[model samples]
Target: MRLKNCLFIGCLSLMSLPALAETVNNLFQVREPVSGQTPDEKTRATQAALETLVTRLTGDAKAAQGATLAEVRKDPQQIISQYGYDAGPPESLQVDFDPASTERALRQAGLALWGSNRPVIMAWWLNDATDGANLVGDGQSSAEPLRRAAQHRGLPLRLPLADLGEQSIGNAKTLDGTDVAPLKQASERYGPDAILAVHAQENGSQWQGKWHLWLGDKMEQGSASGASAAELADAVLLSVSQRLAPRFVVKPGASSSMALEVQGMTLERYAQLVRLLEPFGGRLRSVNGDRVVFDVSGSVDQLRSQLSLARLQEVPAGEVGAAPVDAGQTPAVEAKPGSTNVSLPAGTADQTLHLRW
Candidate 1:
């Protein structure tokens, strides 16, 4: 009798196991992590972008979005704290330097390297322990001016190592501000073939450098400052260029000649896209009209494809109050006389190859 009772109990337990397992599976569904993603790098980029969005949405020009500058910064800050941000942690990477020497070397290095590549952003000596924007008290030079100088050389410059506050201010902490862990959450934000995160510092007179290249979270390749600063910067840039340098950044709906894909879209949007793409030659893999696959061909414009799109400044601004451009045009970022910065739409195949750091 006892044996029979024990067998009955065991059978019942076994019968219920499958149902329980199914229930658990639904509750704990696991998604493959973003195929090519990085939380830290993404967070930083997005944090920067979010700041930009705020300004574009609110600033003097007033973006189409109805948000005001203060509100623009505030709302995003709230979400950032929830998403691409976190409260202060106890670690730090603060190092001591001549400040002047470090800034000069970095600024010059940045100028010489990015001169022809991307547009200039603001530069200034870091002041507050936030966003690395400290402007040197003396105010002689900072990342901002050099960053601006780089832009003058013809890339669409954003703000530089210094005076980033003037670029697009947001609420970001410094000291422990790297926010690397958070940025790891959204790695694609940089929009580069290879996102280059480089660090240069004085290790008792000799500069030390480190770089990381990633296609999302997976670190592709990297090098430390074994070589000179120029060598280090050049090597990193070249590596990134090599990794992301495709003749064409193709997509599914891009063209027969391109390699890319599209997720879900509408017919009207597709038709509109077709109109926009009349200039390019590409292959369509499959077209439901509403959904399309394409193969875009050729290498993208090397400079534009890899780095952030920056427009040229015809007449550089000498001071803060001076409007960077003449009246009618609204001082657009992409319409510079000698430069261009276009925001083209995406391709199909849903395929993307990017750089994450």
Candidate 2:
């Protein structure tokens, strides 16, 4: 079960928090092509699907084969909720893993899991075919492969409309250029948190792409080649997932418990805050006026990444009116009626963190 589920079960009514980043739905759902419907084939396909899911969630291509997940690989159905075969040009198996069970299992295995709240990626892809070079637009047929790739890798990808002005800016020079001013200017209208630029060319029947990803102050660039466009797209998205996961994934044993204070809390904001802090094992420490304190466990970067989703501002440690409050030093106050019990950790002044909602 998710840590939030443990803390809030039957305690407070839960509602979806307004997320700053796009929440990629169906992260646990995976589909892998199969050659036949035989029992052995289905079993093998199921294992392959589980491997794909583990890779997608942890951003480690070999996670499913790791010693930590050996038992899970032996009994793949332990966390699966449902499965069915999709009759396609290439037959495929669609597996839906129970999210809670899967999460619990992964945590128990000591693997770092990436949350569903992922950044929205705007992709500007320029394709060079034998006939000519063109940009892949939002409504174009060529964009379908990229969408499938994004979904398979659990990325929220968006394509521009490819209007005349955008096409002018989405050229080879702009895609390959180190300077992102032109691309960022064009991407502002799309409102994506990250920008992806790809220049793919088809030589004979093989496809290869040079890609660049820009997020915050970080920029990553790489090249990928595949037998076809679909394969190339999948390779590129997998690389992107690998790059993005480390920024958010909270590995086991890497977290330190600390006191966190969030000011400007109301009933509604409280609900939102709870959901946002779920991954950090956020436990209510106390409530004073609109300010609320929590005992949370995670790295500073991970906490900052999650709280940024709610537009929370971090108050410096020694601010005049915003000094960090040690939860242990604060007098104990009874939790509101029907609230679940959260054990407050023993903390000192230096172990406290503060934020403003």
Q: Global lDDT of each model? A: 0.29, 0.80
- The list of candidate 1 runs beyond 4 A from truth reads 1-180, 185-195, 204-206, 224-235, 246-261, 266-280, 283-289, 295-357
Residue 198 of model 1, lDDT score: 43
**Model 1 reaches what TM-score against the true structure?**
0.29
* Per-prediction tally of clashes: 80, 0
Candidate 1: C-alpha lDDT: 0.29
Please name the candidate that would achieve the greatest TM-score relative to the true structure: 2
Indicate which candidate wins on lDDT: 2
1-357 in candidate 2: lDDT tens per residue? Answer: 433333345234444435456778999999888998899999999998898899889988978898988999999899999998899645799999999999889889889898777788999999988899999999999999899899989999999999999999999999988788899999998888889999999999899999999887679999998899889999999999998888788778888888788877666566666666666766676656667777777898878866765668888656726544645443332233334454454444336667886
- State every prediction's TM-score relative to the real structure: 0.29, 0.84
Kindly state the number of residue pairs that clash in model 1. 80
